[model samples]
Target: MMAATNNKEPQRIHPHKFTLWVAMGSIIMMFAGLTSAYIVKRSQSNWLEFSLPFVFWYSTATIIISSITVQLSLKAFIAREMKQYRTLIGITAFLGVLFISLQLVGFYNLESRGIPLFGVKSNSATSFLGIITGLHIVHVLAGVIAILVLFIKAYFSKIKNYSSVPLEIISTYWHFVDILWIYLFIFFNWPR
Candidate 1:
């Protein structure tokens, strides 16, 4: 006897992907709360306004370029161009390091301008800048680590398939951090 088959789609999500999404949502909520606090604190009488460091602009550009490189890497992987994929992943990791270095330069620039994070002269603006950017740096570091792992796997001929879910998940997280930085940059630099 032949068995009848039901063609309904599965209602369950992959646990890993679902966990990542939940983590991302939590991150979004945390940032939203921090930014909201920033906005509320900006209305106080002791708020100090300052120009963002020029290096931040450069870092912003670097991150944007890195985002492009990551997307290119994904494309190359999909095309089974392992060499190109590895190269692009390396470039993305390099750009991530550059972004972190530029952020440090920005902090130094702020300090040189007498806007230290915890000195008597330090104000809410500088504190917010430091906190927000520092948190973002942590996220970028995580992304760089992910990219390095992918690069090492590719180098060792471990990544045989182009349809890797881990690669897609990492790409999504990278892009999220990229966009988050862009938003924070605009928010910090917006004219009062």
Candidate 2:
């Protein structure tokens, strides 16, 4: 029996982590720009008075829960518990979907409340709010897609070995986004 030679270590590091961070940083910058624009616009006169969509609160809660689940998944991976890891990942993805659905519901609630979100012509506050949430929705959609990809890789692929680095990376990014949303919510809807 010949001992296996050619012992180059397998490149176990996942490629997605770097890409996800780059993408997430871009997303953070995008949101920061929107929030800055909001600050500038809110300072202007003749801005219509309106309350933020209530669904935002619900969405924020959902994102927090999703972050918790992602953390659990990362812990499971560290513990080498494949079933719990996969289950937690699935739960996180479902929470992502729930977050998106809540965003749409928020838009509907705003419409029902007669808030105008039409481009530049809309009231300054509404316009800024619309842009902020709209960009956030786009990012959330991207996150949902990423979650789906993770699901497919974790469940469907034959790759059973769970890498702790990838799981932690995903959790880090997900938690950052989740916290960002909470900050935005408080900033946008804070009582004057």
Q: Give TM per candidate.
A: 0.91, 0.83
Query: Taking the candidates one at a time, how many backbone clashes does each contain?
Result: 0, 0
- Give the per-residue lDDT of model 1 (tens digit) for 1-192: 989999999889767778888988998998899999999999999898888989999999999999999999989888888789889999999999999999999999999888897667788878988898899999999999988988888888654755667777888888999999999999998999
- Whole-model lDDT values for every prediction: 0.89, 0.80
Candidate 1 residues lying further than 4 Å off, grouped into runs, are: 1-8, 11-13, 157-163
- Which residue runs of candidate 2 sit more than 4 Å off their true CA positions? 1-25, 119-121
TM-score of predicted model 1? 0.91
| Model 2 clash number | 0
Backbone clash pairs for candidate 2 read: none
Model 2: how large is the Cα RMSD against the reference?
6.1
List of clashing residue pairs for candidate 1:
none
Give the root-mean-square deviation of each candidate in angstroms: 2.8, 6.1
Worst 10 residues of 1 by lDDT: 157-166
